[model samples]
Target: MEINFKGKRALVTGASKGIGRDLVIQLVKCGAEVVAVARSRELLENLKKEVPSIEIVPLDISDWKKTKEALNKQGPIDLLVNNAGLAILGPLTEVSEENVDELFSINVKSIINISQWMAKQLISRKAPGSIVNVSSQASMAGLENHSVYCATKGAVDAFTRAACTELGPHGIRINAVNPTVIMTAMGKIGWSDPKVAAPMMAKIPLKRFGEVHEVVDAILYLLSDKASMINGVCLPIDGGFTAT
Candidate 1:
């Protein structure tokens, strides 16, 4: 199905690279005015060059005070994609307080903060809106050395549900997308070794990692009016990995 976002406005965090960057481009192609947020002004500037009409908001979404101010300045947004996250992998035995704090600050705290900001805007305006939080399969499955990352994503999924409960009454829908390893730069490097990838690959019915567009397609559908009835669902785009 062809989904359109004409006359809508979207705010996508982590818009500098990987799935976030591509999502920004696709949202624009679907005719939505977009505000792309990321830490790297230089990279965001380059993205602006490619998609000239998109507005860029350069900030670290983990900064609670500044994030609120930055998002408030955006006026009104019709769609929100809380795609910014950090993954610091380590075993439970090796995890440190600093690592845990940083991961939760970026991955969990940022999502809650931004989603609240977006929901308020939509609620105050009495506008119906959609929010897609970019969570991960790690939230549901246990990986060998991703204890902290998994914890953060788990929190994200729980928060998505809770937020939906409150926001649904305000005509705001909130959901999450948990994707398997996609072939982004980070995915290619982390899973490059056959030994590392084989165990995970064996579990997937499709026996392959996901591509960027596959996840993006799922997200776009959730963000559009096509998924109006879908709320508080943590949809997995894991090539049937979760199924196995």
Candidate 2:
């Protein structure tokens, strides 16, 4: 079935750049009213310049209280894309406690807070909606220097499943899209040197890095009516990286 988001209101976190930006553009293109959230006002402004139809909300997801207040002011959101996250790469032994806490707070806890808020609002209104958490393939396997990041995404995967079970009866579906490294600005920074890129590319059967639209396409499908029966599962858009 052809996917369309006409009459839907979507809120996308981390929408200033990378996969989040692509998602906002795609959602708007498909006729959805989008509220784009990001911490960077400059980047958000630039995004609006590119796509004037987007409604920009500049706020950090790490600030739970402020995020909740901001979201409460927005009325009802039909789709919540919890895509804000960070990766502070380092061996577990060397990673500071503060960094570990930040990783969990931003990557895991914020998702729960936002999803909970959105789910409650939608359920109270008896609105049918979707929640898509942007997780990582790192949640599926361990990697050197990625222990804490992995743990946070693992929590996200589990939370998505558990949240779906509770919210499904209320007509609110929750799912996650776990992707391997995509060629975004953050990905470029991580793979700037051939030494880093070679090993990463070798692992993927696709042999090349993923494109932003590829990930956004999967997200769009999950958010659309096309995935009406799909819920509580993490779909890996990793180009077979997790398979091998």
Predicted structure with the largest TM-score when compared to the true one: 1
Q: Scored by Cα lDDT, where does model 2 land?
A: 0.92
Error of 2 at 177 (Å): 0.7
| Candidate 1: residue pairs that collide | none
lDDT of 2 by residue, 1-244 (tens): 5678888899999999999999999898899999999999999999999999889999989988999999999987999999999999987789999998899989998999999999899988999999999999999988889999999999999999999989999989899999988889878887789998889889989888888888999999999888999999999888898999
Give the Cα error of residue 156 in candidate 2, in Å: 0.4
Go through the candidates in order and give each one's C-alpha lDDT.
Answer: 0.94, 0.92
lDDT tens readout by residue for model 1, 142-200 = 98899889989999999999988999998899999999999998899999999999999
Candidate 2 regions exceeding 4 Å error are none
Q: Each candidate: how many clashes?
A: 0, 0
Q: After superposition, how far is residue 149 of candidate 1 from its true place, in Å?
A: 0.8
